[model samples]
Target chain A: MPKAELLDPQGQAVQSAMGRLGFSGVVSVRQGKRFEIEVEGQITEERRIELEHLAETLLANPVIENHTLTIE
Target chain B: MPKAELLDPQGQAVQSAMGRLGFSGVVSVRQGKRFEIEVEGQITEERRIELEHLAETLLANPVIENHTLTIE
Candidate 1:
């Protein structure tokens, strides 16, 4: 089996924080969880990227969330 | 910093496991990592996706590796 890191959603995701209009405000801490995926094929480089795109666009919440794919 | 799962490299990552060549040979477990990012801008929807793409293409390894972007 190949390896993958699924970016699942977390509770109370902090999207942004207020700044003094001086700091420009930063996304202090965007948090998320991960899962495992068992797929088919050679796990080629191109397929990996394609899979990642699928994760971000479909598996994950595009509105306020995103996922990082990890292969081992 | 903005929450970002950096798909960093791990040692001896198991990409696939052999079955009787039967398990159809699956990608059993793809592993990856997460990190924090502090960027400039509103962290808008488009921006978030853009950031994720950057992570996948540049920050992450395209071959035998991919990263899932998570925004909290």
Candidate 2:
């Protein structure tokens, strides 16, 4: 998701829409990106490390976003 | 995320880029949208149900995406 301190226009837009639709329980929203990656064969320790590195460097913008990787 | 049977051009593009970047462990990638929502006060059982309804009707595109909600 965008940094906590950053203004998320998209999220704000959704929140506004929700309010218009009468879902008042929602206080705020933050939109984020998700990726489900497939790797052939077993995910060994080395592969896990590589995947984390790739996710940080290529999939997510570290400067503006925080990312997490999970094995199914 | 887009349905598994559906083609995700964005994911395909990313996979191709990964190949070019020499991250061969990646077999495929499926990109999806995420949202972090905050609610004022504690989440009661009724609120949980309402949140689930809201997520299905407003937050996710049920036709092409599946969504899961968790209380973090």
Q: Worst 10-residue stretch by lDDT in candidate 2 chain A?
A: A18-27
Per-residue alpha-carbon lDDT of candidate 2 for residues B1-72, written as tens digits (9 for 90 to 100):
788988999999889888888778677899999999998889989989988988899888999988899997
Top lDDT model: 2
lDDT of 2: 0.88
lDDT of candidates 1 onward, in order: 0.48, 0.88
Instruction: Give the per-residue lDDT of model 2 (tens digit) for A1-72.
Output: 898988999999989988888778677899999988898889889988888898889889999998988997
Candidate 2: regions farther than 4 A off: none
Model 1, B1-72: lDDT tens digits are: 112243423211332222332233344433444446666666788777666665665445666555667665
Return the lDDT, model 2, position B18.
Answer: 83
How accurately is candidate 1 docked according to DockQ?
A: 0.19
Give the TM-score (vs. native) of candidate 1.
0.31
- Docking quality of model 1: it rates as incorrect
